[model samples]
Target: MTQTSNRIFDEMARLMNDAAGVAQGVRREFDTLFRAQAEKMLRELEVVSREEFEAVKEMARLAREENEALKARIEALEGKTVAKASKKTKDSEPPTSAPEA
Candidate 1:
């Protein structure tokens, strides 16, 4: 009778262990499925990756800097042209003089 009881208890313990293993496997599969679905959703939304965003941001920054530099150069050239025109006007003007005594 004692040996029979031991065999039954041993079988029960083995069954419980198998059930725990199966539960763990199901949990792992669920996690994998959830991750796959999330990735698919993000792709469908056309979300940019971090690397692509950073690259485009850097390009925009560089373009802004170039535009600013060009604006400064244009202003400097305009100033020089105005100064030259003023100088030419002064040179072309007749000099004023008092009548001789």
Candidate 2:
């Protein structure tokens, strides 16, 4: 009985070692394949990284802000011109004479 038990223990240990080795090999192969694929994709597509994207987004925001400011300034100038034109029309009109008593 003791001899049988020892044999079983030895078999279990060997199986466990085999499983561990296989797992390690699979992990290494997956790592290598994934890195190669990632490199290939990066070379094929001209994709911006997160940091570069953020910087360009910030620049766009600033440009939008400047555009809005310029639009507001143009609107203000237009308003002033309209007001001046109306004032000139009013000033040019002759006053009516009052009725004599």
Candidate 3:
């Protein structure tokens, strides 16, 4: 009876050890597969990281503001030029002809 019990105990321990080893291997394989898939997805998406996106957004905003300011300046300059030209035309007009001779 004792021999039978000992054999059974040993068999159980061996099986348990094998199962633990298999579980560890499976965990490692899953981790490796998940990491590879994540990297592939990131590459395929062509998405910038948050920090890079934020930086680009800030640059675009600054460019837009600058463009608007430049446009306003150009409009102001054009208005001044137009006013000066109108004034010059008014000043240069000849007087109406006097009565004949």
- In order of appearance, the predictions have TM-scores of 0.71, 0.70, 0.59
lDDT of 3 by residue, 1-101 (tens): 99999999999999999999999999999999999999899989987889999999999999999999999999999999999999999899987887996
Error of 2 at 90 (Å): 2.1
Clash tally, candidates in order: 0, 0, 0
13, model 1: CA deviation in Å? Answer: 5.6
Best by TM-score: 1
User: What is candidate 2's lDDT per residue for 10-87, written digit by digit as tens?
Assistant: 999999999999999999999999999998898689878889999999999999999999999999999999999999
Candidate 3 least-lDDT 10 residues: 92-101
* Best lDDT among the predictions, by candidate number: 1
- Model 3, residue 18: distance off in Å is 14
Model 1 steric clash total: 0
Error of 3 at 15 (Å): 13
The 0-to-1 C-alpha lDDT of every candidate, in the order given, reads 0.98, 0.97, 0.97
Q: Candidate 1 regions off by >4 Å?
A: 1-17, 98-101
Question: lDDT score, residue 45, model 3?
Answer: 95
